[model samples]
Target: MKVLLHVSHLVQWDIALSNSKNLKAIEAKSKIEIVVNAHAIQLYRELSENLLQQLNELENLNIKVKLCRNALRNNNIEESTLPATVEIVPAGIFEIIKKQEEGYYYVSP
Candidate 1:
């Protein structure tokens, strides 16, 4: 199954990443995609090196983390700050709707 995780709340990236880990544990073979919008990117940028390392592990698990272009612009975050695999989608909400419409389960955390 395809799962779309919408992360909009502000907090440590570890929490979001941890949730992703838990989800993966529950559904070992599920295809998980994450959308980090608004303040979430800001939190990720501020994470400590160790936390960032944990986030890097997500890539090994094949979980794609996307940042909202609108949110990046609104927060004045440079593209260079993001990880290489972090995709920039046009609109996070639209992506969520589109994925849900296409049969991906929507989860917010």
Candidate 2:
């Protein structure tokens, strides 16, 4: 299964991450991508050690962490400052739609 997890609000970070983790645990063969956009983009720049560790854990589980380039630009966050594990997409909405077209299940948590 392919899953697209969306995080648009800052408060959704923990819920999104937890949802991703739970999905992986429930199905080991699932392909999961967590796409962070909008105000949630600040989570990347304002990462606490715990948050960073959780993101790293997801990477270790082979989950893709995607950041929206437009959001980053709007928030004034430098790509160089983001964690190396993340992949930046041109737009979050575009990415989500593309993934859905490709048969990934979309979830906003």
Local accuracy of candidate 2 as per-residue lDDT tens digits, 3-86? 998999988878878887788789988999989999999887776899789878988999998999999999999998877888
| Best-fitting candidate, scored by TM-score | 2
Candidate 1 lDDT over residue span 1-109, tens digit each: 8888888877635566877788889888988888888777676555568656765788888898888888988888887777676788998888889889989988776
Q: In candidate 2, what residue range of length 10 has the lowest lDDT sum?
A: 43-52
What TM-score goes with each of the models?
0.85, 0.94
Q: Count the backbone clashes (under 3 Å) in each candidate.
A: 0, 0
Candidate 2 residue 27 C-alpha distance from true site, Å = 0.8
RMSD of each: 2.0, 1.0
State in Å the error of residue 26, model 1.
Answer: 3.3
Candidate 2 regions off by >4 Å?
A: none
